[model samples]
Target: MTAAVLSVEKFTVSMPDATASTPALGLGQDIDNCVPFMTVSSDNEANEAQMVDVKKNGGTNKFDFTATALGARDLEVTVVEFDPAQVTIEEVSFTLGSGLTANVTVGTIVEANTFPIVYAHSAGDTTDGYDHVMMRATFTSTTNLQIIKQVHQADLVGHAYILEALNGQWSIETGASIPLAYTTAQTTKNAAITVTANRTGLWSYWDTSDIGDDPRDSIWDGVITDATNLDLTRANGSTPSADGDIESFVVNFAADVAVVQQGEFNYVTAATKTAAISAPGTLGNTMVVATNAYGWCESTGVTVARATCQGRMTFNSAIEVLGTRSGFGNGEYRQNFQVIEWLIGGAAAAAEPIIIMLGY
Candidate 1:
């Protein structure tokens, strides 16, 4: 048994009024002012196309028509419906990145729901006196949209910007645009940072959450503190070229903990006095046994045990005779002996300073 099902498809067309013409086969026939008809075809021979009467739902628009019951074999539904005259255009205003504003409105019939189409506009006379700018409007929210002007510059052309829409919000995705002759822009600013010696050039951050898992899913520079924490900042200049897509991370010498404290001593691993030293108050009073505890040392860049170190240091045991706190060997010091870790014990004592003691 051939199962039968009914399907409906909607088409929007911008049709003009038909001209009055007589057919050769008919004699003295006045077939004038009749509505035009569209033929619907199907790929499967077994399934026949059904034509339905077009009705005007209280509107004078001629493009308003519906096709009903496009029949086909069970589970085999393939139909073709197209109208070339249905495209239209409207004007809209939007802002650009370089503090410029422009607009474009595209009117096209699409089979599926999508964001409103916008196009680039030519340079025009404005109060700012800007010219030859390519601009695009994107919906920032369901009710809000942005008009961004593309900036142009030398050697930084051909950078592609991808736009992705989600939940009615439009965002310009980040990534290296593929190579092309030149990039079109609406603003007159460099779109990318030029490469220089010992300096990294322009680059985009990859957002792994995009629809296609696109690496260059976002067009921003960001820092990742953890798996869930990401802070994105816009590029200072033009978007980077495709050559700058891959990631090259440089360990900041100032921020790198390892480099900053590479020469520091390990207080815990250093040998400590057999007995806990009492907190020190006076100088050269058989310095009280230091609380050789495992923790970070705040004394940074201090010369201890013939080594320079910075940042906190964890000690496996109490530091006794300056065995080694941060890469410093036993009995080495830049300052007087027993000055580092010299705890001034009192009821209202100040914060303990992570001091490195001079070796005897």
Candidate 2:
């Protein structure tokens, strides 16, 4: 007698949510959470000795059985969950035709591939049944495997079925044995400008250093420079005091990012001040009032440097006039304004600081 070789595919025997009634092997089936039994049969007399068993390997389960038959004949596999108290049962069956006559090839070799992630069929939280049961098994050749996840359970209906993958950072399944993986990465760079002034001075409006008769009033052109004996006064007609505190004003700033998106908090609230940003600069244009607002929300808790990086706020106007004319998504884009002015309720408040943020 010629023996047939067979290696069943991997599958998970999903247990329903119910009480275990029948004792040994849980195969007695008391209804609800009863164990399932499987049987293998074929037309050929040589196939009568075939034994089918489901084995648990880690998170996966496999069906094991004889692969080769004496001459050639069709084989039938049946699985059923029974309730010992009742005769009715939920059963399913499949037919595997003779290896010599069918296109499928049977083998005795142990063929199995493990996935990077472990898949769990049941949540095990409630006695409630599942929407469906998904199983992966190889019934054809050793190399060809088929996954079944859409099988509907008799008790579970209307609800959706899910296969939870717990192992990798990210999982992408295409109904295949192996799934794709994904990870996240990030980088940062500083863009704050620093400088010192030779004399105490007041900051004039954005573009021009001297807007009024007071040449002593000056605003840095959003440029960074360093030197000794720096004068940092910003109120017009203010005496040139040796206040080194003024020089320390524009020193610290956060690193600039390639992109900024809306954060979780809203821009404007009763307790917080709103901030604004402008587009980057182009060849002929500077950040001006006409620049677009690319942000979806307003700025809150904005500081002087952050508000400055965003753009200049008018004396009392709610809008922030960005210094750059260029827009976001440009080949190389950045915040347009290098310098900023602070004001409260339409009046300049050189003393009060603001907070700014660039969301990820």
Candidate 3:
């Protein structure tokens, strides 16, 4: 035998305050404060338009037909058991919108209240099915609140309204399950490096001066002679033979010597020259050398040299950066059911209607 699948296993009803400033009925509410009741069964009557056929006296065939206008729909609920101790008798005795009207007691009117109601269905014995099915409606005690006492149980009957299409009196929605979280992949880009400077200088010297004195003194004198020259070459003394004589000079500079070198050089003097140097264009006469001298140069007004590198940014997919997800359908539908009116009353016997209708 094939097993039958039950779409709805059970149902629940929630009641909300009708006296709220903006009373929203039949969407969802906190059921913790509501009185608990066991419902035996429930049913509904759509009460759609009724068609009337018109026939002509001259012919046996059918003629034109007209349909009666649609009216309010009905939903009946049969409750078998409820807790009477949870509510006070004085609170249930007064009927809503009836100026505290009282009803004739058959045994004892346990409870009564007027409010908007929401009906929800639970999926039973199905994995791939709707999550919830909710419907909105209202109950009034002036028309249909019935109570009957049996041997051990009392039956309470009430009616819900599905009024006009303008108010959206009755609506049912089925919600499907959807995903909540998503995963996204992204990519990083490569960085670039940059270098900057105010000026660059290169200096080269070929030492050719005598070892007894500082050869760098001639480079300093030459720098003083031409402070603005970018490429300056200067020698310390005249050319010497293969004897113990050292020659030194300096070359290129991007800026002025005083600006690059900052100041003059201070040196310690030697006791005597290692070898006496003949004066230029003199006959056998020797020139005396005393202290040692040195010079150094650097570029000026260079605040920064290099800059930090930056990388190009990329993404694996457009959706990753856009924050859009895939494989999930539309989410739940949550529209509150609108209620026009609410009524509350008590019934003497189960045979009589719980609600008494004064007029349509």
- The prediction achieving the highest TM-score against the true structure is 1
Using TM-score as the yardstick, the better of models 1 and 2 is 1
RMSD, every candidate, angstroms: 33.1, 33.5, 49.0
- Model 3's TM-score against the true structure: 0.13
Name the runs in model 3 displaced over 4 angstroms. Answer: 1-113, 116-134, 140-328, 331-360
Worst 10 residues of 3 by lDDT: 305-314
**Candidate 1: tens digits of C-alpha lDDT, residues 1-360:** 111111111121211111111112111211121111122222211101111122222133222222222321111011111111221112233323334433333333221112232222122221111121222334333334344433321111111112221221111112222111222221111233222111111111111111211112212232222222222322123232211111211111111001111112233323221222223332211111111111112221211221111111122223232322224332222111111121112223222322222111
Give candidate 2's error at residue 56 in angstroms.
18
- Which of the predicted structures, 1 or 3, would earn the higher lDDT when compared with the native? 1
lDDT, candidate 3, 1-360, per-residue tens: 111110101112211111101121121322222221111111111111110111111132111112122221111111111112322111122111112112322223211122212111211211111101111111212343221111111111121111111111111111110101111110111111111111111111111211222122111121212223322222222221211111111112112110111111111121111211212221111011110110111111011110000000111121110011111111110000000011112212222222211112
Which 10 successive residues of model 2 have the least lDDT summed? Answer: 1-10
Task: Sort every candidate by lDDT, greatest first.
Answer: 1, 2, 3
Reference-based lDDT, each prediction? 0.21, 0.19, 0.16
- Count clashes in each candidate, considering only residues at least 3 apart in sequence or on different chains: 34, 25, 16
Q: Could you tell me the TM-score of candidate 2?
A: 0.14
TM of each candidate vs. truth = 0.17, 0.14, 0.13
